[model samples]
Every structure is written in C-alpha cells, then in structure tokens.
Target: MKFFIIILLFCLPTTLLAAEFKVSGYGSIVGGKVLSGQKDPAGEVEFQVDFYDYAYYDEDWAWDKESKVALQLVASINERLDATIQLVAKAADEWSPDIDWFYLTYKLNDASKIMAGRRMLPMYYFSEYMEVGFAYPWIRPPANLYWWEITQFNGLTYLYNFELGNWDFDFSAFFGKETQTKIKSHDFWRNRGGYYFPPEGVYISGTADVTWSDIMGVNLAAANDWLDIRASYFSTRYTTTSDIMFFDEIDTNGDGIADTVIERRTNPDGTPIRSGQWSLTDFDLSFYGLGGSMYFTYATVLFDYNYVTYDDGYGSRFPTFYISAVYNHDTWQPYVGISQAKLKITRDFDGFGTGEAEEHQIMTLGLRYNVMPGAALKFELNKFKDKGDRSPWYDFSYHNDATLFSVALDFIF
Candidate 1:
C-alpha cells in the first residue's frame, strides 16, 4: 500500500506540479552510540543506557534508527480549500513507507481553519514539527517528556489565530482516537541465570491490543517579540487486552507447588488452558503542560515542564522538566541543557522488593552548525544518571550511569 502511494506521488503530471501543486521533502541521516555504560554479564537485562538505544539504535554508527525521509504534497483544491499528503520512509522500519499525514483543510475565515484526516496530535509545543529535526535546536526533543505510545490521530481539528494586546495567540482543539498493537516483555520470575523447570528463565512475552478513545485535546500558545508561552491539556480513555505466554517456569527447592503462578496457554501435560488474559479497561489518562522559551539577540533560553497522570490505581504520576541555553554565533550554535524525570509509583502491586519511586537526570551539551541552506549538522554528548528503583517496563537489572554521543545531518528541501 505504501509503495503504491510513493509511485503515485512521483507519477503526477508535470503541469500540475508546476502550477497548482507544491512538493517538498525533508530527511535526516542520524547515527549514535553508547560511549560508556554498564555491561550486564548475565545477559538477561536490557537497559536504556543511551539515547541511541532509546531511539532503537541497533548497530554501531548506523543510520537505521533515527534516520528518515519524508515527502509532502500540498495542493490548492479551491480558494478556501487545500489538500496535503505526506509520506515518510523510516530506516527503523526497514525503509518502509508510511502515510504520515493525509488531510484536507478549509479556511473558515481569516483567523480560523478546520482540518479533517490523519494529523499530528498537538500535545506539546513542538508537536507539529517533532519529526522535523531541522526545526528544533536539539538533536532530539527531551525524550523523557515527549515519549508516548501514540503520536498521531485520525480525526478533526479546529485552529484559530488571533491577537490580543501585543500577543499573538494560536489556539487549537482536536478530537480523535487511535488503536495500536504493541509487544511487551518482562522477566519478573527469574534472575540472571536461566534455571528452574523450563531452564530458559521465566521470561514472558505478550501482545497488547491497546486502544485510546474519547481523545480530546486543547492547546494554546501566545508569542511576542522575545517571549513565547504555551500550555496544553489532553485527556483520553484507554483500554488494553493482553495475551501473555510464559516461556519457562520451575519448582525450585523441591517444592511440590510451582513457585511462580504466571498465566499460560497450556498445561504441562499438553492440555489446553485459557488463563492468560490481562485487561486494563476504560482507564483515564491525562496530560498537562505549561512552558515556553525566551528569545534573545545572541542567545536563546528554553524551558518546558510537563506532568502525566494515570488513574488505574497504580498511582502513576510522571513529572518532568528541562531547561536549556543556546548561544548563536553566525552559522554555529552551541547549547547545554539539564533535565530530570521522576516517576512516583504509589502502588506496589507486584509485591517485589522494588521501591515506589524512580528518577533519572540528564545533562547534555551539543553544537549545531548550519552547513548550508536547509541543512544542518549536529553533534551531542549526554551524561545520564539513574536514581532509585529499577524500572519495571525496561527490565533494567540495576541502576547505572552512562554517557552517549550522537551526530546527525538534518536537511529539508
């Protein structure tokens, strides 16, 4: 399906391309590696020791993780109507093409417009240009705050631009829903050594059928000469049904009963079992953010703070913030930032010896050089530290500090 779209994009008539249609593209060739980190000799734990790993870097100095190219087509359907289609190919997906945006916009007036189709969720200040690396000052946005399962939605949005006093205001409201499938793994019942009954460790893998519905969001921003301020609120109801399969289990210490009672699809005697369904239904999740940046003649100061809450009795509240200062010198820019993410988990549902809180701090120094028109080169080094309990989601065996380095060539045309 995606290949067909790519072919169709290039097969358009030359007259239309020259007259009423505009075609443009952007791309990035990014590579990074973990410079220093802890190595788990047991080989059972996978830690997010670097930004590259967090971005799914699979090889040393490879462009197959955060590298991507996107082509966009904009056409004027009428005096007040326009159509846009954006197709993206990402190295992380084996260079498979996907439709990033296919939307129609109608101008309601000089200050208002309405759009319908697939579009980015305006949940943050940079949500609209999150994937356009050339538009941001950092090699990547603050991952701890911007990370989420869903980035886009298929629905409708209304935006209005207005000015009050000396401030220019942009307000947007959107309604949408999304459905996605995700694979998750855990190693709760086994330690480093693969021991016990099955002898492969009590590792479990599962497919989660997750859906976000009743999604509603509103974003407002006001900007003037030197100050830009933005705030956003988003709420959604989510449901997930998981089908988990356990790979190994054991009866250690010669006990007649199994020490772990994980759900499985079949019994040891080859009889079918039906007890591996886990569901989180109609849970409420909300995100709130308020932050902005200050612009100066030779330097820029950026800051943002965000909070997320989940209401499934796990008592999950995530609060994160980052502050950065960038100095601009001709075509070169150097920046430094400090950020922190703290997760407060009040419910110890697993009964393990894990604590109720986890925190991570990061310090980053980077330089960006505008090599030419619509092109930039970036180099960044990051120092990361983990504090408190291990994260259950990543199966990190222990707390460790690490350093990461990355470089990328970002371009738009």
Candidate 2:
C-alpha cells in the first residue's frame, strides 16, 4: 500500500498533458473561530467540528482546520476503459497530501459502466463532491449530518443511466470494504466518561482501527428540469480493535487466586486501584437514506435524511438529516440550513457500548458571491446546540450554545 500511494505523488504533474489525459484541480481556503459559549474543561473556548479529523479552533480565528486543495487526473486507456486519480492536501494535516481516489472504469455500453478501485462512499446526497466547496454554497456541509468514521472504500460499482420520458434516471450497485488505522474517533473519546472497568492492575488503551467489510449498497435516483430525488441502502460488517494491551495476571480458578501472574501491581496505598476501560463495536451495520432537491428560477431547496441500524443490538439507531434553502440573485447567493443527528443507547449490550456520539443540531446562515465563473467567496455563521446527553465531545460537557463564524474562497482550475 505504501508503494502504491507513493506512485500517485509522482503522477501529480498536470501542467503538461497527453492527448489521452486531462487534469483539473479545485481548492477551498476556509477560516473559522468560536464566537461564544463553548469552553473546554480548562476554561478555554475551543471548537471541533469534524470528529473524523479532529481539527479544532479556539476563540481566535484560524484557517487550517478545514482548508484543502485537490488535483484529479483522468486517462483514457482505450475505447472502453478509463483511469482516474485524485489527491488532496489538507490543512489539518500540515499540508500533507493524501489520495482520495484511484479507479478504473470500463464502459459496458452507452448507458452502462463498471468501475473498480478506491472511491468515496456515496452515503449522502453530496458524498461524491462534498469536498468541492465550489459545488456548494457554504464553507462546509453540516457536520452533524455529514459525520462518518469511514468515508472511502476499496470497491467495485456497476452504474446504469437512462432517460424515462422527460426525466433522467441513474442506478448503481456497489460492493467494497475498508480498514482505517489510528482513526481520530478513537482518541477523541479516550479520556472521557467513567465506567466500572476491571481492576487497576491491567493497563487500558484507546481503540486504533476501524474495519468495514463486505460493504454492499444500491442507489437509485431520477431528475428533471426542476426536481431530483434519491434513495439508497447499504449494509456492512463492522469491527473495531484496541491499539495497545497490557496483561497483568490470570486467575486459573474461580476462587480468585492468581496462578500465572504476569505482574503484581496495585494501588499506591496498597488498596484496590481504579483505571480507565476500553471496548469495541463489532456488529452488522445497515443504512437507509432519502434525498431530494427543488430548483426554482430564484431559489433552490435541498433535503437529505439518513438512518443507521446496528444489528444484534450492538447499539441503537442513528438518524441524521439536513434541510437547506439558497436564494440566487445574479452572482450573489445566500442560504440558511438546519441539520441534526440523533444517537441512542440500547440496553441490549447491558448498556455498555454506543455509536460513541451525541444528539446535536446546527443552525446555519451563509452567503456566497461568485467572483467569476470558476471562483466564489463564501461567509457563514453556525450555531451549534447539544440537545441531549453530552456524553463526550471533550473530556467534559458544555450544554450552552456555541456560535462559529467562517469564511472561504472556493475555486477551480
């Protein structure tokens, strides 16, 4: 995997292209800061919008949290086959580059095709182009609705496109899997919450890996001049593993006697000790989603909803949705949005594990000014509200509202 990804770094030259190859790129420079109310346990105000990346903001304005630049290349291998690759440099990673896509597509017919390789998971309406800030009116998508631990997968997809009457239709089925190491969600919830864990002799560590296998999904959609609609379903096997382990002692019998003791460590005062705990979420996961858009001469309205179910009662349901309306005025566009996610805990696992999330909502107000055909300037203000149990966004909880302001320049070349 290291060698394969390293090769992409060399293929990034786009200035000089062949007849069969074309290159294009896009970028977003976004800056944001917390306005009021959100403070950490140390009494310092801070902001963290994306749990998957763990990029953050403080009371002062900052830019590196969400800005990124990406390049894409498409090569025509033959009459029926084409190859593509995309790489991105994210500000949160100190401008380190990461590969977002590398795939090959084979045209089966004029209306059908098949693709194989790594690509973003189409779990939401904007999943395919979510990072292209120029494609959306806001600096970013609603964090509550777009949150997902796994965004990309190594997979194969069969796509068919056809027109029925005055409307065009698209249908696709995909199968793939992905394994992520040293994920952010693991450490984000590391030191939060308290539980009745094993004795203090054993060492506890945070989780490190998230594996999604046997991922299969189908998406169907139709669109006309004024309206478009979509629906999708997906299922996969989920597993999470710990990052570190320390074995202390083993009781050979039910009599609580340590037979083959690995180590004998106890409390500082020679009393019973207490330590942190760790666990994993291993289960079958299912997803259902619905989305639609309405376009008018002066305005556009979009809505998306998604529901996730963890089978075998490993956890409860996760339902998220977003609704936004944008009004267009020549080169100026203004928008407002509302989005939320509901995370529930079930007693099926004896109240042990959850999706490791909270129930929250965000209200958005933003504006976009098209500087030119391929460039835009955006400004947005978001109000974040935690509506339910604040299990752990930080090591502690902040029940009050936190307002954030952001601005961005979205461009393509």
Winning candidate number (lDDT)? 2
**Model 2 / residue 395 / CA error / Å:** 8.7
Distance from true location, Cα of 198 in model 1, Å = 17
Reference-based TM-score of each model? 0.81, 0.82
Q: After best superposition, candidate 1 residue 146: deviation in angstroms?
A: 2.0
lDDT, candidate 2, at 266? 46
The alpha-carbon lDDT assigned to residue 258 of candidate 2 equals: 67
- lDDT scores of the candidates, listed in order: 0.71, 0.78
Once fitted onto the true fold, the runs of candidate 2 whose alpha carbons sit more than 4 angstroms away are 1-19, 41-44, 194-207, 244-279, 312-314, 346-348, 351-357, 389-400
Q: Output the worst ten-in-a-row residue range by lDDT, candidate 1.
A: 44-53
Q: Best candidate, TM-score-wise?
A: 2
Per-residue lDDT tens digits of candidate 2, residues 229-256?
9999999998876553335657778687
- lDDT digits (tens) for residues 1-413 of candidate 1: 33544554565454245437889999988887767765444332222422312353322556677789999998876678777889999886678998889877899999999998778887766767778999877887766566665677778899999999999999989998876655221222234332112224433333345577888989999999999999999999877654435644567776776676545655689654322343434579898988788999999998888888888655677888889999978699999998888777666655633344667777889999999989999999877677646544344333346677889899999
